[model samples]
Target: MKNYLIALLAVVTFGLASCGGGDDKAADNQEATQAVEQKADEAQQQTQEADNQANDNANQEENQEAANDQAAAGGKDGKTLFMENGCVACHKETEKSVGPSLKEITAKYGEDKAKLIEFMKGNAEAIVDPAQFATMKPNLEITKKMNDADLGALADYIMSIK
Candidate 1:
């Protein structure tokens, strides 16, 4: 009877230990699963951010391309061309700097846009400031290379300054 009781006690103790160990293993597995899930979430968030950034960059590039295409199609106005070609450095709408003012040029041309275009093309002589022809020679060279449409736009802009 004593041996039987001892054996029963040993069996119960082993069973209890096994149950405790199983609980500990279950807890460890739960912690491991949570860690894996958290890492996956972080990776997903990073991927989403990267995708958004790529989309933003693509949008910016598309906008820039559209603007370039518009410019190529002669969408640039005369004022934009004037400023781009450095005309504003020497001339102003009402004030004269190194060159005659737009108002003076317009007054001299007097609704004659063709004559102004000719002068810009270096075909006609300078009538507004003949003595300043030497200073205008370089600018005339630049204008001489412009297309007729651009020259017409520039002339129109000058004529409208009054």
Candidate 2:
């Protein structure tokens, strides 16, 4: 009976020691997994931040290019030039006649003032009314030398006529 009790105690001690190591291994594995997850999360966050910054830079560049184009076209205040250049003779603010109106011009060109100047330069066609432009061939000869800045200003004015 005494030997049996001693053997049982020895086995219990051995089992306890073996169980302790299993808990240590489990804790180590859990810690390793948590660290890997943390590193992955950090990497994902950094990538997301970089993507956002890149997107911001692209947007800013696009806006600057647009501003440069508008500046080249005399920007938003070109109306005074349009009135001085006799453009109003063939065109009205909101109505059409021998020529289409300023409202129609804005609808055709939106705020792209450079395109308006290019059309005046004869580098482009009048998209709004190709037929009406045939009536302006005589005027085009006169307008060819009117200068880009002046023409862009006139276009800007037309865009803002409303």
* Top model number, lDDT: 1
lDDT of 2 by residue, 1-162 (tens): 999999999999999999999999999999999999999999999999999999878965765565467677655334444566666688889999779888988898887878877878778888989876778666776557776656655665666554
Model 1: lDDT to the true structure: 0.86
Question: Per-residue alpha-carbon lDDT of model 1 for 54-103, expressed as tens digits?
Answer: 98789657645644655789576567778999999989999888999999
Give candidate 2's error at residue 29 in angstroms. 46
Relative to the unseen true structure, what is the C-alpha lDDT of residue 8 in candidate 2, on a scale of 0 to 100? 100
TM-score of 1: 0.55
The residue pairs found clashing in candidate 2 are: 79-157
RMSD of each: 17.7, 11.1
Residue 128 of model 1 has an lDDT of: 91
Which segments of candidate 2 are over 4 A away from where they belong? 1-80
- Tell me the whole-model lDDT of each prediction, alpha carbons only: 0.86, 0.75
Give the 10-residue window scoring lowest on summed lDDT in candidate 2: 74-83
